[model samples]
Target: MTQAIDRVRQALLQAGHPDTIAMFAEGTHTAAEAAASVGCSIAQIAKSIIFRSGETPILVVASGVNRIDRAKVGAALGRKVERADPAWVEATTGFAVGGVAPVGHLAPALILIDEDLLALDPVWAAAGSPSHAFRTTPADLVRVTGGSVANVKA
Candidate 1:
């Protein structure tokens, strides 16, 4: 496994999550690709989106089928947020944009989870590499990341 994937695995284990990481040769770079690879609905993919509020990185774990409402997020945080650049995402999360995981970020971040994801029993998230992913529940995600569930869907 790559160093990024290893860090994610270690973070999951330290958080008491029991799921195993799965690597796909074809890659899980997009939500559609990940759902197809995992044999799940598009909404079951919990995509981690990173945004920037000034110098701070904010993580929004949204359902695959839903678009995050930046206005809502900004309102919740009382700060305006913009899409983070690719390099900033990598620097902030210690993973590439397409492979940013909910946990194991390199820098401190305020994490927010989409409320829609909570309705799904099992969800898939990126595992620090474009080819890696893991299964998890929304509640478990919140637990591991210490994130708040909100209406992030647009």
Candidate 2:
């Protein structure tokens, strides 16, 4: 398969995100790295965290500043939540940990968008590669991921 970044770019385009995918010379493997590269606040970086709910993968689109409360996740999903390992993250999303986008999954997973992101405009998210990012509004993210708005932050 081609690089996951390309798939992310296509997904963004197809989902009607206003901005194109941005690739930095420096890798955005972490929210702090992406923040430094994009000149945005760390809070403005959206991280896609995948957790296993039995057989299903749940993608939590959260702000960099917040830690996902797994207990809250369980409450939201009404099931036990298990963290996905590196191999599972890759196999489920077709992207590595630092590069998972909110869309273009190999299969659709239930998504939860952190309510914190809604307070900020023009947040940046991983574009299927550690070196690529995309600018998007919280509304667009909800649209692209078909995510539900929730307080998943800790």
* TM, every model: 0.96, 0.95
Task: Give per-residue CA lDDT, model 2, range 84-146, as digits (tens).
Answer: 998988998898899988888887788899999999988999988888889999989999888
lDDT of 1 by residue, 105-131 (tens): 889899899999999979999999998
Tell me which residue pairs clash in candidate 2: none
Model 1 clash pairs are none
RMSD (Cα, Å) for all candidates, in order, is: 1.1, 1.3
lDDT of 1 at 8: 88
**Judged by lDDT, which candidate is best?**
1
- The list of candidate 2 runs beyond 4 A from truth reads none
Compare the candidates by TM-score and give the number of the best one.
1
TM-score of 2: 0.95
**lDDT of prediction 2:** 0.88
